[model samples]
Target: MQKLLKLILTSRVYEAAAETPLEEAAGLSRTLDNRVLLKREDLQPIFSFKLRGAYNKIAHLTEEERARGVIAASAGNHAQGVAFSARKLGIRSVIVMPLTTPQIKVGAVEGYGAEVILHGDNYSEAADHCQQMVETTGMTFIHPFDDDLVIAGQGTVADELLRQSAGQMDAVFVPVGGGGLAAGVAGYLKALCPEIRVVGVEPADSDAMARSLAAGRRIRLDSVGIFADGVAVREVGHLTFDLCRRYLDEIIRVDTDELCSAIRSIYQDTRSIVEPAGALGVAGLKKYVRERKVSGRTLVAVNSGANMNFERLRYVAERTLIGEKQEALFAVTIPENPGSLRRFCSDVLGDRNITEFNYRLAGRERAHIFVGISIRNTGERHAFGQLLGEHGFDNIDLTDNELAKTHVRYMVGGRSPEAGHEVLYRFWFPERSGALVRFLGSMGENWNISLFHYRSQGGDYGRVLIGLEIPPKEEDGFREFLDRLGYRFVEESGNPVYRLFL
Candidate 1:
């Protein structure tokens, strides 16, 4: 512990990294009724804190090691870090990125004079290929995390935080991915001031560290959600996990909606946009304060990065209101008679601002309507549902239904009773060109596609909701085909939103 602390204090990072300003989030503080400060790590030269560790690690390499060059594997920000740092040090760098990685990211690394190798489909696969190249080429592999020098370099963040805040903040929130930033911040903060709390935040779908800490061992996930692609590691690093376990007070997991909401809030506060993973600290901080109902305390969250893809803003904007409890969604059953829509507005809705309303007449007896309404607070959804029940309307609250939001809302008018033996699936396909063509081409000639909804978040993956009609006997064959295709998918035939909308 003492050795790590000493290394953190003496580690060289400022040679390439700048000391970012600690700014107060007055808008958020006003809303949450607490003092909120954001450590603006997003202001780094690479628009991420990753360069601090990447530069420091390369700087400390032996002269012979430098001559051999450096090789690293990353999907995005980390690759930029190593490439930028390596070029500054006049060392040749090889960055192995997923084949599905956007050309924009590839160009960024290449812009820094690094050789960008596009391989595999994702980070894990790229990392594996990177190891093979490292062995074949004998280049020094710079691990993104899990290295002593890298960890110490990241720990420099804590040193700056303490000095800037005068070591008086109540708790610090750090986003955890491979646990590099969290481990560094927690280790250094806890070592210097045992009383200061360090909390790590992770996406709920990608909480490998939380799962590992709970089991007292590292646990690799079968797969991870890619909305927040920056921190979507399937497993935490060994050294980082150990440091996090030793020093972090707790780890908080937040869903995608909450994360989007935090991004909106941070933008309001700082007029700066951060990526989904970048806002994890703010999201977790909001959750902590809401759950604990703490007030008048000095809470700080790290604005880790702002390397956001432009297209995801639409998704983030749409979900932000839902996350903030400003909007509620529902599916309601009502009489199919004339003037029923007017009656729903006058009798049930009664001046409630409707954000969205989708209606289709398919049945003579009843009509199922999907609706979104503005709400004053979270508790209003319960009252709205109760009012619908009391008014002789059968309604299901779809506020928390992911399928409803992601697919059903846009597909409310479709239903195919004639399409028998249909099964629904949600697939995460690589976003590269011809990936969809390959999926379609791979389908069996006998099988039929009945329903499809495709959404691309402009990241590593494109989400597709598809319904297929396959004979019962062909189920085994269909499963085999899906396995052979290698895309991550989940059977969604039983999802309630499918019945209600499609």
Candidate 2:
């Protein structure tokens, strides 16, 4: 610990990286009733703190090692970091990325003069191929995290935070992935100022570090959510895991909606659209404060990176309202008479703004409507439900329903009576031209596609809700087809929301 602290204090990262500012987030502070400080690592040369470790590691490489070149596998930020560092050092570099990586990230790595190779479907698969290349050709492999030097370099951010905040912080929140940043920040801060709490934040769907801490050892996830691709690591690194275990005060797991809310909060203060992983610290900070019911203390959130894809903003915008508890979704049943729709809108909804409304007449006497109404808080959702019930309206709150949020909301049409043997499934497929056609083609010609909903969110992958017609006799065949499909999917045919709406 002492050696690593020394290395962090004397890191040579400034040769290519900047001493980013620790700015106060006034908007978040006012909202949370706490002083929120943002470590602006997003302002670094590579728009990510990753360059700190990349440069520090590469600059210390032997001249002979530099000549042989460096290679790495990354889906985004780390790839750009290594590419930028290698270019500044005038060393040959190669970066292997998953085929599912967004083109914007691939282009950024190439723009930094690194040879970009697209391979596999995710970081784990690409990293496996990267190891193969390192064996065949004796190129130096620069791991994204886990190395002592890399951890030490990342720790520099902690040193800066302590110096900038004058050691007055109550807690420091960090995003956890392979655990480089969290391990580094927690180690330095805990060693120097034991009074300050060090919190690690991870996506709930991809919480390798949190799971590892609970189990007292590293645990590998079978699959991880890719929404926050930057921190979507399946396993925590060994060294990083050890450091985090020793130094971190606690770990917080947040969902995608919470991440989106944090991103929106950052934008309100900094006027910058941070990527999902970059906003994780803020998300954790919010969750912690609300859960612990503590406030007025100075807290810091590391704005880790800002390599956002422009096209992804659409999806982020859609989710931000829900994340902020400003949007409520519900399924309401009302009379199909001409005056019923008017009465429901004028009396039940009152003057509330409707964000979305989907309805298709299914019965002669009654009609089901999927509606999104703006609300001030979570409590108001229940109040609105009570108002509907008083007006003889049968309503179901779909605000927290996964099936409704992901599929049924978009697939809101009455269920098809002729749609026999229908099996609904939600799938995630690589986004590119012909990807949808390819997915449809993979399914045989016998089965019919009863219902399909797909909208491109400009992320690395496309989400699809598919309802396929397969008789009981072909259920086994359908399972075989899904096994061969090679895409992550979940069966939603039996979902109550699906049965209710479509």
Candidate 3:
């Protein structure tokens, strides 16, 4: 501990990395009812705190090692950090990245003038290839984390936090991936300011450190989810695991939805969009405060990086409302009659905006509607569900149902039929404004209209499946109505899957 503290005090990171601000997140503080400070490592030179350790590790290399140059295997912020640090120190650098790495990141490392080698399919394979190159090329390998100097450099962030907070903070939340940052920060905080509890946060799907500490021995995960890809490590580093087990107060695991909500919360507070891994600390902190019901105490969450992929923002946005309990999805059943839709809308929907509604008339008695609606806060979904029961409405909350969200919402058309003269037809309509309303207008009270499925696939045309009660007598008029509707239609009533399934 003393040696680590000494190394941190003298780390050479300031030559490249900035002393980022420790600003209070006023929005989070107010909402969580605690003083929440953000360690803005996301504002560092490489837009991540990684360069601190990368530079400090490479800066202290022996003259002989520096002459040999440097090499590393990474596809995220660590790759950029090592490349940037090596360039700053005028050393020849080579970065080995997975072939699956995004072009934006591959370009970022090359922009730093490092030789980028695209190899293998994932980090593990790329890392193995990097080791082979290290043996043949004799380049000094710069680890992203785990080395003592790297740990010491990351420890410097804790040093800054201690100084900025004046030992008044009750706890500090650190993000855990390969456990380097958590290990370093916890070591320093526990040694110098023992009263300030050091907590580590990791994704539930990739919690190597938390599981390791819990078992009193290292445990490697068989596989990990890619949602929080930045911190998706299957195993913790040897040195880092030891340090974390020794110093950390506790480790908290947060789900992907919680991470997304934390990302949104951080944006609301700081106008900064952080990567999923970067939001882990804030998510864990929120969970901690809620579960413990603590308030008014000073808390800190380290915002480790901001290297979010632009394309992933849409997915994050979609999940954020659900995570924050701002949107709730439900499977509801109501009477199947002409005035039922009108009464259901008037009684339940009222003036609230509906996000999505999928209704398929499969039975003569009850109609099932897959619906999404907005709510104000946590626990409101339960209240809303109870309200539905009060109105004699049978409904099942699907807000936290993973299968329902991922696939079931899109599969609302499959069911056994109870209506006679049902003609199943698959329809295609232009995925444009007012197209759906135009199609709906084609149906006239619709002779006990049976099935309807519509989901926009973000394409030129939206696909829909509708089963109408067109008896043999009105087949001619229904065919004329289909022509006026003008959307492409294919009769699927004879299809085997349709015949067997619905």
Candidate 4:
């Protein structure tokens, strides 16, 4: 590992100007009573640490191999790294990525002069296709962070960290995706500085590396939560796993909420928004310090990447507040009747924002509205429930319910045959600041006799499945106008599924 580190440090990619500042985070360090330093790889040229590996790998290639060209599979940062490095080396490169890769990232990859091939539905599928292309085309397959050369290049980050810190470090927190970054750093650090602790952080939803380490073997996950797309990997690389098993002190898991909070915190302190995977190290550091009651430890958190989607900022912002106990999700059940909605809003939820609401008369002896409320805090969650209980309504917390949060929000309402003449419809309203109440106020119940469903998708739009019973004697003009409301509505009043299911 030491020899590998030396080779990497002296390599072309690793020869870039070092001695980047590792500054103490005044706000966070004060909060934890431990000195916290941020290693700002987010500020790197490609907005990631991937450049180190990409350039190192390419720089070491034989002239003939370089002439043959190179290919890689990545959705964002790695693509940029390889493209930029190839451009710098005057070599041809192609990047294969999932079709769903963000438009901005795709553009960024192209901006680096690499031919971008959009294929597959996910990263693994793209990777497989890239491997097949390598076999057929004879192009050098640049395995991102997986190969010995790539890992050594990534290890150069630790070298820079140590060099800049003047060798004074207690612990270093690194993010784990395929384990390349962790393996590299841990391998070199364990070999050189046996006393320093090296911890790997991973998202709980995609913890292949951590799970593999625990099981003493590599295991692939069937599915992964792609919220942290950069780190939502199913399997650890073979070389990376071997190095990590031998050197890593521990691998800690953090949830999406905590990662989001860390993103917000970094933005607050450094004015930089990092992707979910990038924030894992800081989130893990927070967890580890509190859980172990560590004090006065000199810690360095690697801010891995900052290639965040602009649209996802809302989600990260909202979830971060929730993770910090500044927000809560509550199900407020109210009596189903005129003025009940207004009464609940004016009374219990007067100060709180209604992030979501779904009304249904599902087998209710007395009508009850199933409302999702986002409160100021957890105390307000309990208070709202107490208020509902006092009003003879059951307040169940469905905040954590997957179905309730996503699909249920939009799969609402259909008119029953008993309602002689009323059209029904559903829509996904935005889940922030008066959006719901404003939508309701805009659409008064002029003709209401049907079903409604709206679940949160952790997104702006909800997938609403609504059914409405149209008036038997409706005119063509009115029908055409109703159709112009721009919603995907299913007239299931006459359908057998509605008759049977509803």
Candidate 5:
């Protein structure tokens, strides 16, 4: 531990990295009733703290290793880090990335004078291909976050935080992926400032580090959510897991909605849109403060990276209001007589802003309406529901229903009686060309695709909601097929929203 701390203190990352500011987050502090600080690693040369570790590792490579060149596999930020570091060092670098990686990231790596190779569908497959190339060419392979040197370089973040904050921080929140940053920062902080708490933050669906720590060993996940692509690692590094297990005080998991809210919060303060993974520290900090019910203590959140895909902003913006409890969705049944809509609007909705309103006359006597309204908090949703009942309207709160949020809201049409033995499933797959074709082809000739909806979010994975029709006797066979499909899927056939509309 002492040696690791010494290495972090003496790291030569300043040659290619900046001493990013530890600025006060006035907006967050005011809202949370605490002193909130942001470690601006997002302002680094590569727009990510990854440069610190990438440069440190490459700088220490021997002449022989440099002459042979270096290779790495990454879908986003780490690719930029290695490309920038190799350009600065005047050495040949090759970055192998998933075919599904955004063109913006691939172009950025190439702009830094690194050879970019597009291979496979995801990072794991691309990494396998890169390993084969390394064996054949005898080039050095840079592991993203597992190596001691890389971990040491990342630890420098803690050194700067303590110095910049003057060792007065009550807690420091670090984003966890393969566990490099959390391990490095926590190891250094715990050694020097034992009084300061070190907390690791991870996406709820991608909490490999947290789960590993709980199990007392490394545990590999079958799949992970791709919304926070930067930190969507399936397994934590062996060394990093050990370090984090010993140093980190706690690990917190936040969902996609929480991540969206955090991104909005950061944008409000800095006027800079942060990627989902980049805002994870802020999300975890908010969750911690609320859960612990603590106040008046100084807390720091590391703004890890800013390599955001521009197209993802649309999805983030849509979810942010709901995440902050400022939006509510409900299904209301109203009389189909003339002036009924006007009466409901004047008496129930009043002057409240309506974010969405979808309606269809399904019957002669009544109509179903899917409405989204702006509210101050969760309390208002309950109050609004009670108000609707008093106004002689039947209503159901769909605010927390996943099916309603994802599919049924956009699809307000009632179910079709002709569609028999239909099954609904949501599948997550790699977002590469021909991937959908492969999935459809795997279904065989026994079933028909009755409904399908897909929208790209410019991330590594694509989400698809599908409905299939099959005979009742084929139900067991369909289940077996899904299990052998090799994609992450959830059966949504029993979802209430689907039964109500679709």
Candidate 6:
């Protein structure tokens, strides 16, 4: 490893990156009360530091080996790195990726003229399949992080940082997925400047390297939460792990929520959006700076990549406010009497909108309603729970229930669509002062609904499924109004079973 590292130090790859900038980040430095520098690998042509390793590896290949082409497996920046680097070197490259890899990344690899084979559902499975292909095709495998040359090439980032910083960095935070980037940077920095701290950051949901270091041996996770999919590897590579053991000072884990907030922060401060994996180093630095209170230290954080999917932004946006947004679900038992329901809605839930309501006469005197309500904060969750307790209502808080997320929202009752020629498809209007009375008013004076269901899709409107019986002559205008309002409806009025049941 030392000999390979020495060779890499003298290679053309190192020479190529000797002049990369390591300018100070005045904005972040002030925020942390420390002198801060950003290793802007996100500015690489492939938008990742992986290009350093990829280009170095391909450039070192002999003519005969280059003629045989190279193969690699990666679902994120590594794939783009290898593709772009191989194309730059005028060598053929084949990249194997998970079938579920985002279309954006797959297209990027193909755009670089690499033959992309989509296989497996995740990185490990894709990597396994690629290894099999390498053995069969006699093509040289350009590993994403495990090889000595790749690690050495990655180490060049540290060399550039030291040179640009005039050797003043007190600490550096590197993001760890399979540990290649962290190992490479840490290895080179520690080998040259033993006093400089090299810390590694990993997503809490997929901290295989951290867990492995704790266990004092390599351990593979059976499954990893892939919220930060680029770094959602189940295990660190063996070679990379060995390097990490030698050089890394400490491995810190940051939660998914922290990563999301960090993404938002980077966008706010720099107007640049980065994927969750790319934000790990920043997130870790924040936690470390606060916890350690290293106010005077000079810190560097590697901003890794920006391959964020636009669609995933919605989820990140939602989770960013989960603690602040009080979305609650409850199963409440109410009296079977009609007026009892009215009093509970008016007296107990004053101005609190019932997002969902469902009742069933389960061959008993009382009724049970699985209800959902929205609040402004988590504090309201306990407040609402106490309100039910005071009213003597049997209630269960199910805000975080998986089963409720899937099924409870659509449990409203209404009649069959086929029998009611005059079916009035009504949106569950949550704005009424006495929502229960409004619901009963819409149902009929004495008319009972045979079917009703409501559930939120985490959108502006909650979807409600309802079937109501009405006179045949009055249905057409109601149907038109429903269409005009853009509400989705399924008609069951014509079905024989609905007719018979009604």
* Per-candidate count of clashing residue pairs (backbone under 3 Å): 0, 0, 0, 16, 0, 18
How does residue 181 of candidate 2 score in lDDT? 95
- Model 6 clash tally, residue pairs: 18
Tens digits of per-residue lDDT, candidate 3, 1-502, equal 8899999999999999999999999999999999999999999988888999999999999999999999999989899999999999999999998766777888999999899998865678899999999999999999888799999989999999988988889999999999889989999999988999999999988998989998998899976656777887889999999999999999999887888899999999999999988998899999899889999899999999999888678768878888777899987788888898888889888887798888876778887788899998768778889988888888887787654564456666747537789988876665446666777776756555677766543223455777788889989988888878766677877754444235
Q: Write the per-residue lDDT of candidate 4 for residues 198-291, one digit (tens) a residue.
A: 9999989899998999999999997666678788788889999999999999999988778887897788778889888889889999889878
TM-score of 6: 0.67
Residue range 148-193, candidate 2, lDDT tens digits: 8889889999999988989999999999999999989999998899
Candidate numbers sorted by TM-score from highest down:
1, 2, 5, 3, 4, 6
- Cα lDDT over the full model 3: 0.85
The pairs that clash in candidate 1 are none
RMSD of 6: 13.1
Off by over 4 Å in 4: 15-20, 334-393, 407-502
Model 4 Cα displacement at 211 (Å)?
Answer: 1.3
List, residue by residue over 160-223, the lDDT tens digit for candidate 5: 9988988999999999999999989999999988999999999999999999999999999988
**Candidate 4, which ten residues in sequence have the lowest lDDT sum?**
492-501
TM-score per prediction, in order, is 0.98, 0.97, 0.81, 0.76, 0.95, 0.67
lDDT at position 208, candidate 2: 97
- Cα deviation at 371, candidate 5, in Å, is 1.7
Where does model 3 exceed 4 Å of error? 363-365, 407-502
lDDT assessment of candidate 1? 0.91
Clashes of 1: 0
TM-score of 2: 0.97
Local distance difference test, each candidate: 0.91, 0.91, 0.85, 0.74, 0.90, 0.72
